[model samples]
Target chain A: DVKVTQSSRYLVKRTGEKVFLECVQDMDHENMFWYRQDPGLGLRLIYFSYDVKMKEKGDIPEGYSVSREKKERFSLILESASTNQTSMYLCASSHPSDRTYEQYFGPGTRLTVT
Target chain B: EDQVTQSPEALRLQEGESSSLNCSYTVSGLRGLFWYRQDPGKGPEFLFTLYSAGEEKEKERLKATLTKKESFLHITAPKPEDSATYLCAPHEDTGRRALTFGSGTRLQVQP
Candidate 1:
């Protein structure tokens, strides 16, 4: 079974503070993604990494940045946390050749920016 | 633009009731459709993946079927544990690995 683990289950940060959310996967998948889930907006992609040091912006990447220094780890960074940034953040990983393109997800981190 | 839409924002069902959830997409050159179940305050759990029209997959009491433009998740004799939000995402062959997800259908099963 594949396992994806996040650094935190819940976090609280003050406005303008820097925040980091870490994710690690044991499946050695080549693709990793960061998404934020809101009530009506669904799961909107924030950023994704296809390989080490390779990153791509998704639909809503303006306030977020990601790092993929290693294959097993992906980190999401918030330059300046704001109340609007509070949401459930999810991390997922998938292998390119998995035909199904099924992404295994972590438990998610609920960040609260106050 | 690619889009995925789910119908019946919420559904309430009695235990042992049978129903289906719908997911429609407008992505061109469809690659795959994925179904996931999510409980409150947690990430989604993958359920099934449909690759092409006429394809079907099942697990226990849940069955997923795909057509050219939409997919259906049919639940049979659901139990209270079956209550969760069902999400669908459609992947397009646009050389991007990201999937556009639907808002999701929230299901509640009362015992």
Candidate 2:
């Protein structure tokens, strides 16, 4: 079975701290995505990588960055954490082929900034 | 913008209740439509994928049907464990990677 795992399920950080949320996928998929889910606003994409070292900004990429140093691993970095950045962060992976449009998501990391 | 919308922001059902959830889209060309069920704290779980009009797929008590402009997920005799937020997304024809998602409908099944 395909599995996606995140580094943490819940995280609390202080303002101005640099936070990192890591994710890994067992399937050698070519696409990885980071999204922040909030009430009323739904899921807003932050960044996505189609391959190692290739990243694209999504609808809400401000104050967030991603790293794809390896095929199985992808990381989301908040350069400066703030209270507004507190939200549930989700990581997802999918195969490159168009057939696998369905993305496999991790359990998610609920971050709280204070 | 590849827009997608889901109706009935919330739905409450009793055990064995039958209902349907709707998802409408206004993209230029429909590449694919996806359905996911998300729990309170966990990520959304993949449920169904409808490719084109007249396409349909079923698993357990849920049946998904598609048309030119919309799709429907029909639940037949739901259970308490089935409560979750249902999400719908439409894949773009060109990129095929990015998906435009709807606001989702929260379903609470009462036992």
Candidate 3:
């Protein structure tokens, strides 16, 4: 079975502190994505990587960065955590082909910036 | 810009009741439409993938159908376990691998 695992299910950080959320996929998918899910905003993409060391900014990329140093791992970095950044962060992985357009997601990390 | 919209933000049904969730999208060209089920506090799980109009796919109590402008996720004889937030996402031909998602339809099935 395809599996996506996140580094944490819940995280709390202080204002102005750096935060990191990690995601790993066992399916060896070529594409990885980071998204922030709000109550009414749905899932807004923050960043995505189609290959190692390659990243693209999504619609809401401000205040966030991503790292894809390895094929199976992707990370989302918050430069300075603020109250506005408190939201559910999700990580997903999928193949780059149209045949595998369905992305598999991790359980998610609920981050709280206090 | 590609956009996805889901209707009836929330739905309530009793056991064995049937209902349908709607997802409408506007894109340059449709590549695929996806359905996902998300439980509270968890991530979305893949349900169906529709590639073209008139395409249909089924899994147990759930059926998904697509048309030129929208897609429907029909739930039949839903049980309490069927309660979840149904999400729809569309992939366009813009060479981007990311999907544009709708806000989602929250379904509640009570016994």
Candidate 4:
């Protein structure tokens, strides 16, 4: 079984503060992704890393960035947190070589910016 | 542009009732269609993966079928524990590993 764990289940941050959300996977997947889910809208990709230190911007990458210094860990950072940035952040990992392309997800972090 | 759409935003069913959820997609080239079930405040759990048209996969009371342009998740004799949001994502063979997900169908089963 693939296990993906997030650092925090819930977080509250003040405006203009920096926020970091961490995710770790035990499956050693080659692909890691960050997404923010909102009501009425589905999961929108924020950033993804295919390999260590290699990152690509997803559909909504603005105000968000990611880091993949280690194979098992992926981190999402917010330069300046805003109320609009408050949403359910999800982390997922997949092994591209599997060909099935099914991503295993973490429990998710609900960030609230005040 | 790739698009994935799910119909009947929400559904309510009585215990022992059966129904199906729909997921329609349009992409450059079909690679795989994935189905996931998400409970409240939790991440999605992978259910089944459909690779091509006419492919079907089943687990317990849940079965998934794929066509050229759509996929259906048929729930048979659902129970209260079967309630959850069903999400479908289509992977396009555009050399990118990202998947475009649909808004999801929220299902509620009442005992």
Top candidate when judged by DockQ against the true structure: 4
For residues A31-106, what per-residue lDDT tens digits would candidate 3 score against the true structure?
Answer: 9999899997899889989899999998899999999999999999999988999999999999976645588999
In angstroms and one decimal each, the interface RMSD of every candidate reads 1.1, 1.3, 1.2, 1.1
lDDT of 4 by residue, A1-114 (tens): 779999999999999999999999999788898989999789989998889999999889999988999999999999999999999999999886654358889999999999
- Kindly report which residue stretches of model 3 are placed more than 4 angstroms away from their true locations once superposed: none
Error of 2 at B11 (Å): 0.9
TM-score of each: 0.95, 0.94, 0.95, 0.95
TM-score of chain A of each: 0.96, 0.97, 0.97, 0.96
Better of 2 and 3 by lDDT: 3
CAPRI verdict (incorrect, acceptable, medium, high) for model 2: medium
Lowest-sum lDDT 10-residue window in model 2 chain B: B91-100
Q: Model 3 chain B — which ten-residue stretch has the worst lDDT? A: B91-100
**Candidate 2 lDDT over residue span B1-111, tens digit each:** 538889889999999999999999998688889999999899988899998899999999999999999999999999999899999988778653467788899999999
Clashing pairs in 1: none
Clashing pairs in 3: none
